[model samples]
Target: MDKRDWLILQMVYAEKNITKAAKRLYISQPTLTYRLQQIEKEFDIKLFYRGRRGVDFTEQGELLVKYAENMLKQQQDMEELLWNTGNEVRGTLRLSVSRTFAFYQLPQVLKAFNKRFPKVEFHVNTGVNIDVIQSIYKQDAHIGIVRGDHSWPSNKKTITEENITILSYNKIDLKDLPSMRRISYKTDPTLEMVIDNWWKENFSSPPISNMNVDNVEIAKRMVLNGLGYCIAPSIVLEKNDQLHKIFLCDTTGSPIVWKTRVLYREELLELAMVREFVHFIQDYH
Candidate 1:
């Protein structure tokens, strides 16, 4: 079997559903099924059994999946090694980034990087900061960009820092936080903890959340509409936005700061593409 075959097997194993896997591989459902049949015939074994919900791998199929994973990983390593030995920074750069950074910063950085290394390719995944960290730890990505502080045992560098702020359409006092309606979003856990701790330090009661949003961008919009006030990292806020903002501070009156970091395994730095991309990010802004 070739690399495409191995990739099909891996995608099928990850997605379980043939239709989903076919869509991800950019192949027709019938084509994917035919390929799977060919692979099974070549091995003389049934790799999976389709049920009402999806497909389940047999014991042999599980073994094949492991083999496919190892083969793909080795192939990637070889490719990276070859590219590293050469002077050209041409290879896939797998990256995982927090949603906020992905939305606010990644596009410009990627545009500039692509201009510099036109032959280089990117495989990017955007999620919460914890997910970004996990991707780096698992070696699923060559690099990770995360917000807030995390205790990751890897090479990391701070890219930027911003203050967490209480934002509203109109001016408000710190003591009025408990009385006002607060807009909250599901975001980085470390940021959540910081905000929670800051709120708890000054007041006996929790800040009342008026709306629950999926991301900080939405929460910021809601706050701008005068729906409610929100606690947000300053990076996501636009400078020209008319919202009144107050920087959150610790009990000693120091600003509560949020830092963005780029994380990666030390060994990945050996690859030219990874090294170049990391350097580009470090010099960005």
Candidate 2:
């Protein structure tokens, strides 16, 4: 019906429990229930089915939730767009970053950036490289921190580069790697092809992987426990990790390296906040 109603639907759908939603919205449970009943009656639909556990949205309710989400996003964008027109560097900065970089280095970077521009707010998301690229393409995020080798036709600057490494609790020879247990984790498809190509270059057969993990951190844990060795970018390797690092090389004896870059849409550079951030981040590394 209105902005408040839109928010009510979004929060109720997100939390699924009216009590939790009310708490988050800073309203009483009865008030939220009444609002929901009014909304349902006005639309002449059974929005949700209440149960002992929580609530399940009916088909119509799900559709309305999508509408509510879109409205809220548009509202946020309108406000940020207006802010961008001002001379002050104060607005939301939608930033998506690679998960590995988020874990290892992002906090310090954010802290320094905040010190430089205190008025700017951050709406940050972390995922793999492809997700970062997609956010920029879709304009869901103004900037993205992407990793691995990529061909971006627009504005991008390198933050850092590191070799793809074989990490182990103890030192081992490269010739023994194919026979030993190898830890594997899900990564971006581009990196997947790179690793697969590199593997085929060195060995005639597939690796003998004993463990598969959801992310690089879990695989690193397995390596630390001496379960198996893992191949990953050396960004995760730290001074205190105490793990043996073996950099992978090409057939020509050149080390295989991956880069992290800051990617942004060309037109987004017109925003003062975006321009300042793009420059600030490159100098961050």
Candidate 3:
């Protein structure tokens, strides 16, 4: 109900233990326990299932925790709006992004943003594109950068174009690719969409000989080490020249060019800091 309660809930959810959460919050264990009891009394639901490893959230607790976290974020955003109503650009900007973009594309953009608005602070986290979108939607993060088709929701904006290719070490021959293993996205719809349209025109089946990887970097590493071939953005080649391209996919005949994007909540569009960052990246090209 109050700010402290929201903070306590978030910490408890993150740490999954009352004692540890209390210690981290600089509060006594009994006090923390009492507060949690008060929350359960107020909400009329058990919030956690105690276990030897850690506390696990009940279904209701999981839902409430997400609500509480989002509410806290909104409160923080409101406070920031009031505090910086008429001043230099300043406020915390929590941005989520995929690992590939975080490592490959974001550093330059962040450096430029920081140089332009030195007062602004950031909380950045990296994961796969799906998790990044969930972070923005949950209000755990303010913005997200990800690769997708150009056809995004009305709220999303395309930031750049990416062409994915199946590449192997230059020294290796393409004739051996069918016999060798391959690395690819794990049931990834985005890549599967590409492969579907791509393979229909080129071959009868998708690259079934390959193994699915969790991420792009691991695939690139495997390809670099000659473990297998991988399908990745052309930027990977630009970033690591030594990997050497064996072939470029002729995706011109297919609708498979991956569009990288910057997405934020539609409701936050009017916020000056948010708009500035969005427009900054939108205008980058």
Candidate 4:
């Protein structure tokens, strides 16, 4: 099988549903089916069995999936070696970044990097910190940018830190927070834990949340409208100068900090592109 065939196998294995795989591969369902049939025919074995819900890999298919993963990894290593031998830093740099960073920080970094290495291409996956870490672990992304601290069996570097604060439209006392109308939004679990811990330490009762929003941006807007207060990372409040900010601190009086970090497998650093990007980001902040 060729590179495309190997890639198809990888994508199919990653996404169990044929329709989903086809969409991700940017091909027609019929085409993907035909290709899968060809692969099975060549190997004289069924790769996967389709059920009512989705598909399950057969024994032979599972073995082939492992082989396909190794082949793809080797292919990438060979390409990296060739590029490095020639002292070139140009290739697809796959990245997984936190949703908040993707929205506020990634665009500027990409613009600067693109200017320096016009030949390099980027494939970015934006999600919560947990998803970012998972993508990196699965080799779907070459690097990850995440917020808050978590255990990772890989090389990690802290990029920056920001304070978590209680935000409101008007000046408010911390003692009154438990009784105030709070705006809550969906966020990463680590941040949620941090907020929960801080709340537990400071109040006997839970902070009343009257409004529930989908994301931090929306919650910030609601707070801007004087709907309620929110606790958010400092990055989210960079442009909101008028907002009253009361920085959260631990019992010892140190500011509660949210850190952003870059994570990658050490072996990926062998690639000149990956190494260059890592250094670029390190110097960026």
- Highest-scoring model, TM-score: 1
How close to the true structure is residue 173 of candidate 3, measured as C-alpha lDDT?
Answer: 64
Q: What overall lDDT goes with each candidate model?
A: 0.91, 0.91, 0.77, 0.91
RMSD of 2: 3.2
Tell me the lDDT of model 3 at 174.
49
lDDT of 4 by residue, 164-277 (tens): 999999999999998899999999888999999999998999989878999999999998899999999998876536899999999999999999999999998988788989
Candidates ranked by TM-score: 1, 4, 2, 3
Which pairs clash in model 1? none
lDDT of 3 by residue, 1-285 (tens): 798999999999999988899999999999998999999999999999899988999999988899988898788978778746877878888899877778887888888888988877888999878888888766787788887753435478888876667777655664555455778755347767765665566554445554677767777877787777776777566644577553335646443456788988777766667778898888764
- Candidate 2 displacement at residue 269 in angstroms: 1.8
TM-score of 3: 0.75
- Give the Å error, residue 245, model 2: 1.6
| Error in Å for residue 279 of model 4 | 2.0
**Which clashing pairs does model 3 show?**
none
Model 2 scores worst on lDDT over the 10 consecutive residues at: 146-155
Error of 3 at 257 (Å): 2.1
